[model samples]
Target: MTDISVFPNSLQKLVKAFEEPLPNLEAPPGMPRIKLNEVIGKVAYFYEKLRNSIEFQEEHLLRRNAIERILRRKILLENRNLVDARLLINELIRARYLPNDALPDAIVGVVQNYIDRYIALLDHLKLRRTSPDDRRLIRWLISVASADIEERLSPSVREDALVEVMYATIRNNLVLPESIPTGQEQDILVYLAIHRALIKSDDAILRYHLFRWAYPQWQTPDHAVTEQIKSHFQQLVEAIERRINHPLSERLLVICRQYTIPFLVLADVFKERPGEIRELLTSPEALNDASEKAMTKRIKSAGSRLRRTTVRSIIYIFITKMLLALAIELPYEVYVLRLSNFLPLYINAAFHPVLMAFIGMSAIVPGKKNTQLVVQAVQEIVNPSAPRMVFGKKLKPRPRSRFRVWLFNLAYLLTFVVTFGAIIRLLQYLEFNFVSILIFLFFLSVISFFGMRVRQVVKELTILTRRENLLLLLLTFVSLPILRVGQWFSKKIPKINLFIFILDFVIEAPFKIFVEVVEEWFSFLKEKREEIS
Candidate 1:
């Protein structure tokens, strides 16, 4: 067996985490159970799938989003009591967001206690209820607390340990510029990078993590602790906002992305031999074999993941197009334009989805050489003697020259004109009217950007550094404007998404009540039968 004494400090910490016993969180006896009717549960599951596709969130984020959505629906829309955590928990289980009976009924009380703490803190702060900023802060704090509660209930101990290992490895390897300055700021940069690159956390999750880091006592804050947080609240918010979009984020993200696959490879290797992780990490030959095996498995899975992501994107684009066409184009044609042509509307609905499917299918998966590269990277990560993978970049400011700025802005404008103008001309040639053209262009840009994002799945599997060629440069020049617009739309559109609004506010409330009544009716029937027997 290889010597454990020779392992790196980071690797040793990982081994210790792996070996540590999971904390006991056994449920107390006599707690009630929340059960859902199978037929109703199946319907709810299908509805969730359909609703989620339109939202376009990362897979890892779906659970937390569901929890937040349920909480919002309960507290905001239905005006339900904050302490009715059992009811909320029941709904989550019925919808299959949480597994059936996996969470103890006592968790209901625990969740309520957590909410009460926040409410108490809010009361103490005495922020004006009428103030929009205060209201927003209250909502945000509760949301973050709910998310923390969900994590505590369903702790990912192994995954957390793995992330910690990745963080440590990254912190050691990264070489920041003098401009970044060595302090908590630099540490936060690395932490944020790992969170983004490895786990694919969205803004809400990042906010939660940042809040936790700032106020570790938030979970069980005393009166004094609450007062401290209240005093620092504004500073905390400003600090988080600044760090979320820190100048060096993109730079560090690139480095973290480079290492993500190799770290994932290590995680996979350890997973297969949980009992022998120490031995495997210590043995170079064993670790190499395991890493190679994991890399091969990942490469195979990458193709299937790409297909799934593409199909989801296709469905999302198609559904969104249909909704927009029905909501906007069809009405415009009938009322505003005083025309009845249906062909352009049908084509608009079909084009973007088909294009996305093509883009997804065309993506190339990593091959043997990439796998070898990943295995080598994994070995380097765990091996103490291996040279640290140093990454450094100097932060630079935007051009201050008026002429240079104007010239750059003009070039960007031309790209927009060239890229979009050509598309508009083609649509006009195809007999698409002004309204139809606008809708089509909107979807095209958003779908193109989304398709590019889906292609990142392939990129994640790749260990080899990507080199840009002339063709790529040319393509980027033409597509840059469209992608930029799409990126902007993707962010903004979600805020005012009509479909989500309809589902959340208009449809979901009554539908959930109906499901609950049906469940109650079934329960009543069972009770009658049991009494007669």
Candidate 2:
């Protein structure tokens, strides 16, 4: 009964402790709970709390928005240039439709006056507030030219005003959450269409002509500006309502913001069909599906390319290893061993080199859905899940006895040291000369280095299961020593290793150049095909 009662209390404490980020403290035998580890745990708990604090969230939002704003500006400039170029092309098409209905010179002057007047009023406000009278005037101007104009052109026109107001609000040293939704696609498009129509309706003027006709002829004075400027200063009163607020571009914006192939390809598609882009952005699932397909296609193409390279690499490694083995063995046998019978020496020299060649070959061989798995791992930042837990609490393994723990550490250290020493001893025992030792070390380095790399790749793709940890522990004995030797060899040479030297200068450069050239040609053809289609 006492044990059962104690269990519930311990379990409750475990659950409550997990609410903090610190791992639950399980008392070790003959040890107090308030040790160095516990102190660190408490520090970590406070750190986690601080990270999730409101101030931190607001800071993160502001930083992310700042990055986004810079990107937006860049993309907008790029897209604006693209729009301008396309606008020239579009004028030709529009000319065919409205040849006689060109914008008159008088109307052009009037349009410029209205634009200048509005800009002056807007500039005077510094984008803060447009009076009801100014709002009415803007609406009246927008409605003037279109025969089919509704009471509201679209929600975008109002949203544009809000966006500019928010932009001004930020400029005025205000940080507010309302600014986050400033760059709605519709609003941006509406602004772009009107702004460009006004600029580029030189050859074809229907859109601008309608806009000009919409303006009221009454010449209202610039009296509102001075009155508003005075009133704006007068209305500045300190009202301590105790409110809290949070805070927060274009073609260059889109290009800088989106890094994925899916996003880029979809953007290109949208360039041709703006309506579809708007529609897809509105429907989350449809947009996601399109993005997923583009990513899948890209991954598949990369996988296929990797496979072809791997095949060629395997063939090269085999030939290179065989020739290199013959070259290394012939000299060692002739000079050091002084053996008339070269067959045994040849066989012995070939063993390590062959093993190394195969390892190199294996590294390049494509695993099933290897590219997709790698992409998935990257997308998840290689940590797909939380560490395994029991209910709400972490399942801390039973502590190893001190004696056993000491023995394990001792064994691990000894194995690491002894394995390296044994490799050196074995090469000496084989009566290998200086060159043979270098060859053996180089091959050994390859095995160790590539094996460790493979293990790391596997480990990343795998979760930390019991079986995985056990397999990893077993592999460490083989991989860790080799990794050390590889590191040492890499440090000693720094610039040149026989294996990488041959691979890089002889094989890698030429093959890479050829592949890139071929790829470029293929890309060119693909583009042409797309254009034709």
Candidate 3:
């Protein structure tokens, strides 16, 4: 074993986390277990898979989304009592969002208690029940509660511990301004950066983090604390809203992404021998061995993840395209255009998925130089003698002359016209009708945006910053306007997603009730057989 005396204090917390036994979750005796019928469970699982395919979300966020959906159905639509939390938990299990028989039955009580506390807090705030702010508050509360439930069901203690260690290490190494106008603490910014880069947290996850920060005792708040929070609830909301989109967040995210590979390498090295982490850090041969192994494993995993994500994206695009064809294209062609031609329809449906597959197949993985950079970065992070990394430089607004601004705007407008104009011209050449051309452009932009996003998997494994070649710059110039449009549509479509609304509101409620009834019938038949036996 290497001497612990030589190791820095920054790593002590991480060492302790790995050395300690993982916390176990046990079920309480005599609490009624919630079970679903096997046949119904299988059906529910299949239905959930189909529903989930409609909305592209990170795989990790699916469970939280499931929780939110179930809660909204039970509480908001069905008006179920918070005490009847077993029904909600049972549905989650039946859908296979949570595992079978793993969660404690008493978790129902925990969920119910959380709902009660949130309701109490809302009442204390005295906001008009039907007001927009109140509704927003309720939605936010539900999202936070759903996230909490997901965590309780499947805790990420090791991940959380790593985040804390990374935060501490980054903070210690980072040089920051003495004071900031943004009013965000440097430590909180560091925490947010780690969550975004390392944990890959989306806005919902970050919002939940902000909620925890705003009300630290939310899990177990007393009357006094509740009252105090009530007085500052509006202010707290505004603060969180501001911080969520703080100007400094993007720069911090870049910095955090820079360190992600190194932190991951360190985690992998320390995973097996928690007690010997200090020794592993000290030994150059061991560190190199571990780094090589980790880099190889990560590259392989990234390839697999890339393929999986690409397949999913293709499937999503194809399904959505077909749905849109049925909803909009077919109707417009038959009624408005009075056309029998379905060639454009066929091409529109197939194009985006084909393009996505092409993008996926063409993507490349990082090389030996990237791995070397990662190893060196990891060494730097662990070595106390390395110089501090400067961070938190204030972003100053650049002043541009009116002529320059106008000229840039004109160039951007021309680029947008040229990009769409070329595509429209091509579609026209192919005998694509006006409606078909519009649909093609719509999916083209959205799919291009998605394709670019999928390409980020390759970037994640790359440690060395890639230099932009002339070809790359040209391609980016052409694609940038389309990507911007895609980004806008991506944000807007979720709010008005017909598929989500239909599944959640139109079909899901009745479908779930039918499943529950079938389960009950199965239970009744089993009881009768037992009695006969």
- Compute the lDDT for candidate 3: 0.77
| lDDT of candidate 1 at residue 461, scale 0 to 100 | 86
Worst 10-residue lDDT window for candidate 2 reads 239-248
Model 3 residue 339 distance off true place after TM-score fit, in angstroms? 4.1
The residue-by-residue lDDT of candidate 2 on 128-202, one tens digit each, is 222655443333222221111211111123222322322221122222133334444323332333222211111
Against the reference, the lDDT scores of all candidates come to 0.77, 0.37, 0.77
Residue 77, model 2: lDDT of 20
Per-residue lDDT of 206 in model 2: 25
Best by TM-score: 1
Of the two candidates 2 and 3, the one with more favorable lDDT, higher being better, is: 3
Can you give the TM-score per candidate against the true fold?
A: 0.88, 0.31, 0.87
- Per-residue error for 7 in candidate 1, Å, reads 2.8
Estimate the TM-score for candidate 1.
0.88
How far is 349's C-alpha from truth in model 3 (Å)?
3.2
- Pitting candidate 1 against candidate 3, the one with the higher TM-score is 1
Error of 2 at 452 (Å): 5.7
- After superposition, the stretches of candidate 1 with alpha carbons farther than 4 Å from their true spots are 1-5, 20-33, 78-81, 127-130, 172-179, 319-347, 387-410
What tens digits encode model 3's per-residue C-alpha lDDT throughout 1-533? 45566656656666666777666544556645555677789999999998987677777888888888777676556654342567777787888876666667667887677667766776687655357777677666667677777777777676777787677566655544555443347667778878889878776677777888777887789999899888887787777767767777777788678668777777777786677676677787788788888888888988998999899788878888999899999899899988898888899999989999998878999899888878776776677665433222332324468799899999999999998888889898888998788889888888888887888777777766679999999998889999989988888887789888889999999998898889889999999999999
